[model samples]
Target: MNKQHAQHQIWRKLGLLSIVMVLLLLAACGSKDNSTTNDESNAQQQEQTTEQTTEQPAAEQPGATVYPLTLKDDSGTEITLDKAPARIVTLAPSETEIAFAIGAGDSVVGVDEYSNYPEQANAIDKVGDTTTNIEKVTALQPDLILASVTMNTQAIEQLRALKLNVYATEPKTYDAVIEKIKNIGVLLDKQQGAADVADRMSQVKADIESKVASADKPSVLVEFSPGWTVGKGEFMDELLTLAGGTNVAQGNGWYEFDSEQIVKSNPQVIVYSSWYEEPNAILEGINARPAWKVIDAVKNNRLVEVPQDPLSRVGPRLAEGLQSLAKAIHPELFQ
Candidate 1:
């Protein structure tokens, strides 16, 4: 009976050991499954991160101008160039300003008398203004001649007759002016410089529009000369529109408006070019006019004087002109 009891206790101990071993094996298998799941999750996270990096967009780069490049001028005349022009002659102040602004100032060997904004242009040889000297232009032996279709009509014709490369421009709107600048840049192989100028002008325009978006557009009259005002289809007219003002002049292009017509329009803002003779006297004359006394601009003394070069020349400085007009028309928003 004693031997049987001892054998029974040994069997009980063996049973307990077997149960502990089984529990340990099950815990090992569970740990292995959990480790495998964690590895798979880590791999998936890394793959998604790589895909996001690969989907990023590349930065834009400036394009190179291919030579023997042929393009149409603002005058709608097609011109071809064998290579970048080394010697250039500008027949207008706007062209001179554009050439200099595009980093091709050194290439300008001759310029019109009015191209005086960049001190460098003033140092260059003067070709002509209103009427270009054909002999002087020929003597320069320019590879490229920049002219204005409107300002240098006869000069362009004469130069072209002489078998010279004359690229004429006549930008009527603000966007047209910017496009002209970019086009000039391409001709001069200064694409990056032109792009920079265009970007700045666009930024200024965008900023002004954003500021004046909610404001009311005031009635404005831009008198570059006595009795002379710009109407629709001109950069000045577009500048007024962009500056948040309504041009009071009637008809298209530049024209003379009678005192009676101006009185009827009754513009809220009177913007006159500084190029006018006796600006102070002119302002005084407008203020003293008894008929114009009822006009809001005259009554409130809202006469703003802007530099003629920036406003008149459809060049890089046109952006400056736009800002000045905006400040004059919407003083509160700018402030």
Candidate 2:
């Protein structure tokens, strides 16, 4: 009986040992499977990381796959440039100034009569006045042509009829003017150069605004012509606001005002453009007007004369014009 009991105990011990060995072997197999899965996951993650690294540069490349550009002009005309313009013709003085500002002056083959700011623009072949001489423009063989609202519609159509690339620019606001400069830069492949000029103008504007923040805003009037004044929703009005003044013109668009209206507005300052070749003579004429004598602007002698082109032409020099207007309106602050 004792031997049989001893045999039973040894068998039970052997069975327990066998079960422990089996459990250890199963654990080893499970660990191997988990290691294989982790290795596969790590390989996939590495592959994905490599793919992302390679694609980043191609996606972020500037101006790549963006050539042969297509865009719409202010006139809603579609224009496509196969590449950067080699030869450009500008029909407006403002457009001519913009081309020169963007460092594309060398490519400007022809310009209108009024493009006289850069000195270099005057040296270019003249294509006529705002009317645009089609014959001379055609002779220039320009790869690109820029026009503005001042250009006659018939002349613009004639240039377009010749299958010449013509972009009409008529920026109604100050922001629009900067956008036009940027677009012109992109077209000329001088994007960085254009951006630099635009940025500088922006800085100039900000600086002027900061300096004039606490200035006393006085009522002002801009007599562009004898009896004409720019109303609300125009660049002239914008300039007045920037210069810490108020435009007394109430109507929308350019309109004629009589002496009675001028007296009623009672502006504190009257700003005129150099449009009149003889600015002094024009100011004298205004000062001598019997009805204008009653107005505060004439009595106080706050008739400020600003350069016509810088204020009139919506181009790179717009900031300069704004600064000049600020100086004229708030001379004390500027000084």
Candidate 3:
């Protein structure tokens, strides 16, 4: 062969070999891309499967309460219910509110005079207040008598003496109040309603805490009644703390605070309950006090008048009260 022809043949062979190598590389890259895409698809499928397995169905979840249920009250008294209470009577305002909140309103045969919320409760038979009329309650033929261990001690004893079922509640904290509501739901066969109320309360509390989490806790004084204040070991105190305020009241439970102590604490915000007669007069009286003029709450015009029922009563409306209190304490954050 001629030298030129031989060189041309060698060049042709090299070009063909290069083309084949390029084709093989392209095939390998395509295979790798396809494998990676398949792996990602499989991972997503597995993740979805895991999620499906972890989630429980409504049918599989806890349902209605079994019959003949027995439970203990806050006072540690054991009581058994043969069936859900068809007719119920509440001796305390808190218990009445809980019953109404938990969808047991229709079942409430009677309520104390102070159970004045929900408007419908006012139409119910008045069975008196903390000191309920045992005869009136008996006439209602209540299968369950809801009372407060602290507020309706005498009524509970009197009712139980007449062979009545009295479940008295005495929750000391905010969480305990929620638990009590849930227990009442079980007692009245209104579990779903109770859960809904509890969840709402929890959400309200969480939202309030989150809003005030970064803000500085201000010194606060809560006067639920005239010349009365709540301290540690009470739900009101917990509400104050949760609303991002440091309670100036010292001691545990309810107590009377004098003008001297009020001047000493010098709270930045003062929350007074409007339940007392002549709320405007009460505010005027506070403002007129010569020593209180030097106090920060009075000086800065931070005197907040709150409704008496929701805050003072340990009931479903307490969360609403907390929100109101939070707004009063941290108006800037709320606004």
Candidate 4:
């Protein structure tokens, strides 16, 4: 009875023990796999959350805010922009230039025929001239329109009726120009860039002021090619001040001065700007007149021909204009 029964019993106990050990090992492996899978899932979720968190700031950028902007322009026209403007259409060339400076040039979808600067702006569709072409502008379907109050007021009203935001520029002085830039920056949600530009302008203006403050004041005559003089608080007056010169036209705005006024004022420097490409015709008109000889600026050969495009534009470029005016008024100061 004993030896055979003992051997079978020992073998049966060993086999059962082996089966139990195999089941336990399989359970342990399953548990380990489950833990690894859960860890990987948690790691993936954390990475995704990090990525989303990082992207939120970029997505939170200010763009075309829905707020009101009420301000006056150079022409003393009170204009209101009731939201941050995206998708802009500018009627004035200088206003479009301001848009570019404020980092919203991409938003300008349409412009008037004169809005050419920054070069890339030339690619945008032209709404029309300073007058008419309302249908053309409407076709482009811009959300905002930047213009001058000098343009027909009815046009602004018409655009407004279509629920478009029309912001007008009316800068009376250099400070007002800075304000206009800031307003445009706020309107386009590019306030940061605008502030930078404004700061740069401030530095330049300060530098020019230092130079002008030291210079001898000369009598300045700023004339258009056709002999139209800007009298009194005007763009020419500002330019003359920057050049350390006294504007002969001080306080009368723009006017047609008789030849006698030119003789009587006895300006020390004469700066003429022509809207024409050559401006030779205007110069010819000036030289041909015997009355031009009487003016001190003319007799002294102080006639300077200003490069009309940049010199005439009243945006960020006005600093350069001031430099040009300084040179015209006092070439020795620049040298």
Candidate 5:
């Protein structure tokens, strides 16, 4: 073989080696690029998983929305009242009525059975009748639970265990009732309505005072179911005072006195109330008892029966109750 031909053959073999090396380098570069892309994708998926896990903690708690509330309760369990409650439940009719007056009736989820007024109250779930129903109340998931000192106490305690905020109310007189109404209004975010109601009540009181000056001041005896008598501090006593009458009873509060005591007092006028109207209902009671039969008011047939609406409801109509009392004391004065 010639020397030049041998040199040519060597050069061709080197060229073949160089081409194989370039192909191997390209294959290695592709594998590395694929590995890097896979790593980046896996990192992105892991980051998404972390964000999903972090979001779960936020879901565990309630959202940050504060409502305003003013809690006024005398004798009940302690509660952490942070803000106003949006949804409320009342275990007593009095509290429910107060809520209605404050314009928070729409937010009420449960009410006592005695809250039969306004017809809409019937649409809400019944907690009890002037009482409490713990299970039903808790199921409502109310942010606030309103009760009365004079109402069922056991259920209030049971509700507290469920971490519900409770407020108990007591209003013995007109002034206290106004204050209560205002506080309830604040709790339900009805400050304006409450103020208006209080202002109106004050005006009504002032008007009653003006009207009462010319009326005959009679001595009165108020009786209720099962022979209840009004004493000092009772709403009836307050009404009588406004109506220019003297409620002749002991202690000036509410009580159940013996028939002999009522007969002996011998009020100039006797007032009777019942769930229903039957003239004999009041007449027979006094007739059956000889002591009452001889009383001056009874002998003179000076007993009066008031309509169920104005006499029973202690809400806005309480002002009307006082007016009725004045009319009964002196019909000519009202005219």
Candidate 6:
């Protein structure tokens, strides 16, 4: 072949080879782009599957958010609830009553042995009294627990150590009792129910106060047991004052009184609580004290008996106790 023709043929072959190489590179780049796109799509799909498997369904969420609910109990311990308590345990009769009164009765899964009010309370599982059955309480798997000073302190501490949420109450006055009731309501999301119950109790108390505001205030002695009487700063003492009667017991809290002090105090009306099954038996025991006959209350037959639960229990029935004591101390005014 001629020299020019040979050079042209070589250049044309080189050009064709370059064109083929370019085409192959383009095909490889297109495959890499498709592979990358497929990889990205697979990663997104796997992430979506993982979320579906791990995340909770909206329907499975609780009706109310229990988390973020935090408050300091009467014992001064701070408590945080993760979810609204579906099961509750009460360690005191008064706490049980307050819980039920605030429309949280259904939530109470267990109560102390002394819980007898509201009739239904009697049917609830009893986990013992101040000496609570921690095992039984634990078995109930209560989300929330109610306690008080009345319960054994040791047991409360043990429950706390078990990581159980315990809210203690030690309301000493009628107002404090109402506040506790409302607080329980708030804890259980029953604020309206608690407010209504508290309002009704206040109205009843106000009525009694108005009726005896101008009445004569008499010196009264409240006998809890045979010789035990409540003193100042107690719910019973405040109830006496509210009912237009002065508590003759001198010291604070509860104390034992002797026949000498009773005679010296000379209470116009002697009041006995129905803690004992037979109130008359309590009166007999009181009368048995030496030199007791000389007391004005004994000689004048001014002894009266009142329901112990209503008077002593720090719960919804405290207003009833106030009225009962008012009538007992001043029958003429009530009549």
lDDT of 1 by residue, 198-273 (tens): 7789789999989888889999998754455677656678889999999999767655568889999999999976
lDDT of each residue in 1-335, candidate 3, tens digit only: 23333222211211101100111100110000000112233223222211121211223322365557666676667787888899999876677788888888999999877667789988999987434688999999999998766556678788889999988766656776776776777678786787788778988999999999999999999865445566776667888999999999997655557788899999999997663355354476687789999999998999998765677666788898898899899999988
Q: Flag regions of model 3 displaced more than 4 Å.
A: 1-62
> What are the per-residue Cα lDDT tens digits for candidate 5 across 60-94?
32122224222335452334445657789976555
User: Candidate 4 on 1-335: residue-level lDDT in tens?
Assistant: 13333222211211101100111100110000000112233223222211121111222332333345454333343455555566888876677788898789988888766666779878989877535478988887777787664443567778867876676554546655665665566557685676667677767778878887877898887764354555554554676787688887743654456767778888888887544335355477678779779888778898897654445455776667677787788778778
Clash pairs (backbone) in predicted model 1: none
User: What TM-score should be assigned to candidate 3?
Assistant: 0.80
- Tell me how far the alpha carbon of residue 143 in candidate 3 is from the true structure, in angstroms, after superposition: 0.5
Question: Which is the winner by TM-score between candidate 1 and candidate 5?
Answer: 1
**Root mean square deviation (Cα) for candidate 2:** 32.4
Over 4 Å off in model 4, which ranges?
A: 1-84
In model 1, the runs with Cα more than 4 Å from the true position are: 1-59, 276-285
Clashes of 4: 10
The CA lDDT of each predicted structure is 0.68, 0.64, 0.68, 0.58, 0.56, 0.65
Off by over 4 Å in 2: 1-65, 279-281
Q: Extract clashing residue pairs from model 5.
A: 67-84, 68-84, 69-84, 231-252, 231-253, 232-252, 232-253
Can you list the residue pairs that collide in candidate 6?
Answer: 67-82
lDDT of 1 at 323: 94
